[model samples]
Target chain A: MNSTAQDEITAYVFAVRAALGDLPEAQRDELLEDLTEHLTEVMADGEGPLTDRVGSPEAYAAELRGTAPFVGGFPDPPTRPNPLIELRDQVLPVLRTADVKVGGVLGYERASDFGRLLRPAWWVLRGYLAAMVVAEILDGGDQPIGLLPRIGGSDGVALILLAAGILGSIWLGRRSFRLSTWPKAVLYGTSFVLVIVALTGFTQADGYTRDSYYSNVTSYDNPYSQVEDVFVYDAQGRLVTGARLLDQNGQPIHLGNAYCYDDEGTYADAPEGVYPYCASKAPFRMPDASDAPLPSPAPSGISPSAAEPSDAPATPSPSVSPSPSK
Target chain B: MDTTQLLKGVLDLAVLAALRDEDGYGYDILRRLRTAGLGDVGDASVYGTLRRLYNGGLLTTYVVPSDEGPHRKYYSLNPAGRAELQRSGKVWQGFASTMDDLLRERGTA
Candidate 1:
């Protein structure tokens, strides 16, 4: 065979080998040798030059390969599984649905667990500090005296509690309780400073006078007013009627016939003819003749006809009087 | 009784019968089947049957190498394969004869 034809034949044999890579090496080699012999015989049978009868190398190789046995000792056909058949026959749709649900639920659980384990303490402290700084920036320098009272007030105490909580949570979360002590201490210190700063802003905003500040921090009503007569205001400066004022322990106090006035000037008065808003079951309080006689009405410069009866409830008076005139 | 099952059972018989006299590879088997007027047999089916027969030890395999091109693997029937062919041929003859008798009686009616 010509050199060119031989090269083409070699290339064809290599292609067959590549295609049959899965076959055992010995079987593949035997097949290649047999094909070479057959080609030689075909060339010898031709009358003209080997090249003339063989034609182009590509054409001859094509003919040879086309004649190769594929199954009953023929060229091996490419085998592949049908995907549709596999999906229909082998995979269970219900199982896949179950898998997806389980996977989704597991993912949510993991996320929640991570948040619980690593987020709360750090987030609370950071949020608290950031809020304080924002307040200071908003307050600017308008009122410094107002800031002092807040720093010294219950806000100061709340900051300390929050700092302690954060340190405790961190210590509990650590593998070695001693490892994070310094960082925890630093966090507490920083939290203290932030709380003080925030309280200062609170004071500057005159928050001390606000019922929320007094109720939440001072555990008392405005010092200027009786606790039972204190009223809470809404964001719009309206008296939130029926919103009972709570003590530090979150209990309600009722004083008979008393009227509570909020910042908005809206007032809630006890029922008519009632003295103070006391929690007494009595229908109405009338003068108790059984008690010691009360002092007589003043006569000098006061007209007896003009003097009006007092509306104060006959119930035992509170040890403390109503707030002095503000 | 489905066409697919019917075709699969007959395919092996047809290919073996065609190659009984001549030693031919894939294309040769296809061409000879077509020439013998069995062109309905698909080329792919014949090739697959050839592999099945070889793997079953019924067909002996050899490669004829070419100087001008790639080698070809040739298939021929062994003794056991010939015996099987003869047995299947007898069964087919009996079935055909039965069918012919049934048709003849129907035609008479």
Candidate 2:
């Protein structure tokens, strides 16, 4: 064949090869070789243009595939790639990008046309949910909530839950369209619940910590007590102890005499002698009237009773009372 | 109604028959069929049928290297293929005769 005829045949062969895209590589190569041999022989006879005589390359490929035998023989020529499968192969990966996956949710194979149409809404919701997660993380404070607690706070649990929500939302968003009926439903349901809980956590987390701090301060019958005596409660409502009162630097602060008067003249938790006097002149007097008609311990002459000497400087130590006020 | 549809059913038989007299390459067989008035036969269909027959062990193939553009693969009938050809040929004849008689009777009626 002349070079012109050869180029024509090469181009035709290329098209045929492309059309046979779904065929196994070995089978396709063999088929192309056979067709090339046949085409060379046909063209040597000086036939007209191949396209004019052979029809389109795709139609030719279909006929070739229809009669082509498998390795063992022709056991019903391997089924062609269905149009829907072709569409899926083309569309799914493009839609699965992290940027586009939110919109791709409804575009997944099993998703209905109506669902595909709703992809814009899913896209918007995805943006909002992502923002909600970011907002939650930012507001969650510097200490991230991990699966385990470091600071003896519920912040970790809340943060972990929020993280789960973020992960679940992202996963569910990308694959929602591809998931089968019941599984998609379950995943969506789980995501919905997670997002709600996470959003609620993000909104209320600061208030939660503040309320818990106040409750903990009040949880102790006397906040001025020694570190070991400060009471706390577990989720089980059982009393827990050994908690220390730490300053901002986490160093334990001394609650001397464990009594001080507040700015409101209320009996406050303060160190002894720092408050200039006990919440009353008689220190170590228990607050409950029913427990005992207690005799004042100041005159009891307990040698280590430092509260007895400190009563004289009641007005001089105003600067020192500030430490116990906390 | 459609000869193309009928051709699909009988193309295997035609291919086996085409190889009976002497060995022929792919395009040679296509020319023989075209000369025998199968003008509508597709090049790919014939090539694919040759391959199917070769894979079925009904035909054997050998390459003939040429100074031309490409090597040619020639197909010949094996013993098993000859036997199949004879058997299927008999079946086709019987089916054709019966259909002819039925058509004649309907025409007369």
Top-TM-score structure, candidate number: 2
Query: Over 4 Å off in model 1, which ranges?
Result: A1-326, B1-5
Docking level of model 2: acceptable
Model 2: CA > 4 A from native: A69-326, B67-69
Clashing pairs in 2: A256-A271, A256-A272, A259-A270, A260-A270
True contacts kept of 2: 0.54
lDDT of each: 0.52, 0.64
Fnat, model 1, is 0.02
TM-score to native of every candidate shown: 0.26, 0.40
lDDT by residue for model 2 (B5-30), tens: 77877788888888899899998999
